[model samples]
Target: MSRELEALMLDHGADGVSFDTIVAAGANSAIPHHRPTDAVLATGDFVKIDSARWSRLPLGHDPHVRSRPGRRLATGDL
Candidate 1:
């Protein structure tokens, strides 16, 4: 599903993006962006999303560039 979605987004022209395609269950749901383990969901479990989509000009280009004066958030802290 993620591959298909990515292909679709690219085909439609997405400049930049980030994602967390978690498939968690049981206690894992509470772990946030949890990778599946041997644990299983019993009766009630849910998935979480910490995903984002962005558009920016590629380096040395004018398409994905940001035209602002604010400080860019450092990776992992954004």
Candidate 2:
């Protein structure tokens, strides 16, 4: 999702980028919060996304993944 985040940063006229896109899969979910690994994506679990952006102005960009109750996506077969 780095691409998406980069796009977002650019959209808000950010001057520089700080981190890579963090994407985690499968049991990595049990990691509480994790980053993307070389592992592939499968079916039967959930994907958690946590993103952040800091700026001088209130860009009104707030990530709300887990906050949206009941949103589901298959991550891997446990």
Write candidate 1's Cα lDDT for 1-78 as tens digits: 334544555576665445634445545556755664555445544444333444666578755532222111221221
Model 2: how far residue 18 lies from native, Å: 7.4
lDDT of 2 at 29: 60
Q: Residue 25 in candidate 2 has what lDDT?
A: 56
lDDT against the true structure, per candidate, is 0.45, 0.52
List the candidates' TM-scores in order.
Answer: 0.39, 0.47
**Per-residue lDDT over 1-74 for candidate 2, one digit per residue giving the tens place of the 0 to 100 score:** 54776687659665444444455556776664476666666666576554444344345654321211222356
Error of 1 at 2 (Å): 4.6
Q: Candidate 2, overall lDDT?
A: 0.52
Candidate 2 clash pair list: 23-36, 43-76
Which stretches of model 2 miss by more than 4 angstroms?
12-21, 58-78
